[model samples]
Target: MSRAVLVEAPRPTIAAPAAAEETPAQRPSRRWRRAVSPVVLVVAWEAAARTGLLPAEKLPAPADVVAAGWRLTQEGTLGVHLADSVTRAAIGMLIGGVLALALGAAAGLLRLGDDLVDPPVQMARMLPHLGLVPLLIIWVGIGEELKITLVALGAFFPIYFNTYAGIRDIDERLVEAARTCGLGAAARLRHVILPGALPSIFLGLRLAIGAAWLSLVVGEQVNAQTGIGFLMMEARDFSQTDVVLLGLLIYALLGLASDLGLRIVERRVLTWRRGLRAT
Candidate 1:
């Protein structure tokens, strides 16, 4: 008994906690899984076109669309049209984005600004911006100005609405806390307000990008020159369904790419947020 009292029992071995199982959302292959349905749909479409179930004239086969794209590429026309479209989009986005940010900030931050700005913006937003194409044509003519203006209009409303909403929706307690911490108005805005509103702003940006593309489609179709929309219109005149479909495909791809890029930026910028996971 005395010898046992002098010795301490060996400590129980503790196995390291088993690693948590990876969920589908955590898997690297999740992105590839998302592509499966689209791939299947495309394959079914190709099969339908080959079997004459889907008329080629009505919706050209994917192969024909690819061929048309390759032909355009060979002729060097695709590069020019692509460049022109990209340039217009870039310029319009820049102009629209700047105006939206400035006005939205003013409206959101100041009571007088909100009273003055929100009413008119709300009224203007109610009018279908796309429906203003005729007025835009009259004001600016069917040239680069018309296209740029249309795109800018399309890009403006979403950003303006979202930015105002985002800033307004921020918790007052956070602002109060910043004030209590001896932070001035500018510091509070930079540290607390902008970060809190970023998610909504990004959402608005994505919507604006889509709208810009939609406006560009209409703008290019109306005008007399180089762009995917113009190419599609020209192909329509010639009954070149393949080329028309190819143009549509290009637009879809561009929109998708832009959204994807924005998403990456949003993720990087909002890393501090624990926002909902797709699961």
Candidate 2:
């Protein structure tokens, strides 16, 4: 009996490797790396333009575009156009954002609301919103209303869809837990739902900002008296390629700046989330 007795040892557990920490010294290098591609592209473009490989008549060099922007700045027209564009965008965003939050919350939180609101919204979103320009022109005429309406329409869907999706995507268990904890509906919405939905909301916000700018560009082109789009149109009539290119560059920079700002806000708001990072 003793000779037949045997024993087994426990297996050793292995721990996962920790993520590599990024030092302060690495941050500047990382930022520099990000700038490399844009720098190279600009250099290549400038070289091509100088060599006549890229016709200046078609696409102006970066330096020429810079000069055009400087000239516009000196003329005082640039500041006025910039201010007008910002005001239009801000007004439209306010209108669109309010509507989106209301509709999206209703549709997301209430079964009856979803049944009533979702179908029309889904159908409407299927149509290219920008394609409504002609109809909008007739309905609102070529004025501030036309431009603001177009921007509002463009900004609406992204925020609405994202907000709806974000609220719906929240865990049922979390809602149940909140209920079990005897939290009121308002409290649950404020603490549990909105916080949980913020990531998607911010994503929508970023997208909406971009859509606002794009809509502004088109709206301003509808016999606009001022704005970057109008400036570009004026330049086109005069065959000023450099000014047109500068307008395009300004648009790109504005969009990029907006997206970056949103990203910073998102990171701050979602500090609890430990998302995967690109190496």
Candidate 3:
């Protein structure tokens, strides 16, 4: 008996549009790949407890987390925690963002000003935000003010550094051209330099927002009556890893939401710069 061998030859490269048409069909396959592991993990987890591979007390199923979150929501505890976290993040981000933008603008405008302010700000940025928590607790007494302050400090440097970099990197050629138009230094900065720098500034803002969220968690975890971080800390004391994971998941979603909202605002404000494609 003779056996037939199956062989395949590679297809030649297709044109752009022809290659692109396959993308939509492959998208579902891509999505399936992304989802397969999580689905498998959930199934395995459920099976593990049923098969005595994992004890119910030690490892709860994803269903338990859903139920736990639902119970917390029904009792209004989750809402309160989420609200506290959101409020802290919002207040801190606004304060930090405003300060960074103003100071960065100032430093960018004047070399003497940058010399006076930029060095120390850069130095401070090198220090971790969480490393400052103990000092903050000692100085500010672990209240709402402390929490907000921690988050503000956490957010400030990213925005300031990026904004300053953007400003400093503004093309001298553009400045010279603007100067030829009878544009004053202030006018050049406000109209030309700042506008040119907006994209970098927004990138910094996105980064600072992420920093703010992280610092908020640390602030709440260390000392607080409320917020998702506090809930997770308390859950840890009770060995409720599921609750801890749930809190973490919620905070991740909140950060994602905040970043998405910021992106929307950024796009609207920076629409003019889109043509430049500096990104």
Candidate 4:
């Protein structure tokens, strides 16, 4: 008879279940909690105002803001000011966005170019856009050019740096594989590098978009322009807090709308990345 030995293999540890029991709808309820949480806050605000918890002059309820906004819209004042702000922001963002894409793509492709321009880029970025108001007014004579230039500058740097970082950080092995597969420089860039760097570019654009809006508002306040910023300033001079608040609310809503659009674009462009696993 031969003696046989039995060996035991180690059992793999079972990980916690990753798929939550919550349905997709339930998963998104968390977002609503945050979204509608503001409703609760607004209610509390109205209650406090009515109950004399706060001076009515110091704080206006949502109802008052709504009424004020409605009044301004009916009067056509808000529409005119809001259009001015929107136009400046849109034009500046378009110009800066194109330039940033071109510059960032160049910097990403050429290390020498990045080194050459990066220092000046950093210097320009360090100077606050608002701080340049006086200089722009002097150089551009307080015209539309001043405001547009300010917004363009603010919107440029974020996209540039993010794009450069994106291309520089691509997986080395992937590039080597492209080289091994006989991909030319242009083909490798077009096929792999640009696509891989897209997420970073979008991230930069989101930041740039916000900056563009802010810079436009600040620039609008500087000169005799029609804009939300001008509306706010004008309302402030007259102690019309409701109009000022309305202008602010418009800005917030517009920013949200633009960001939502960008998110939609991102979803389409990055469909391959959604819920996908990395190696």
Q: Which ten residues in a row have the lowest lDDT in candidate 1?
A: 1-10
Cα-based lDDT at residue 124, candidate 4 = 78
The clash numbers for all candidates, in the given order, read 0, 0, 0, 0
Task: Give the Å shift of residue 263 in candidate 4.
Answer: 1.0
lDDT on C-alpha atoms for all candidate structures: 0.91, 0.92, 0.87, 0.83
Q: Which segments of model 4 are wrong by more than 4 Å? A: 9-16, 19-24, 27-31, 275-279
Least accurate stretch of 10 residues (summed lDDT) in model 4? 270-279
Clashing pairs in 3: none
How high is each candidate's TM-score? 0.90, 0.96, 0.79, 0.91
Q: Estimate the TM-score for candidate 3.
A: 0.79
Cα lDDT tens digits for candidate 2, 25-133: 9999999999999999999999999999999999989999999889989999899998998889889988998899889989999999899999999999998878999
RMSD of each: 5.5, 1.4, 10.3, 2.8
Model 4 collision count: 0
* Number of clashes found in candidate 1: 0
TM-score of 4: 0.91
Mark the regions of model 3 whose C-alpha exceeds 4 Å error after superposition: 1-59, 272-279
Please give the lDDT score at residue 234 for candidate 1. Answer: 95
Candidate 3 — number of clashing residue pairs? Answer: 0
lDDT of 2 at 102: 89
Q: Rank by lDDT, descending?
A: 2, 1, 3, 4
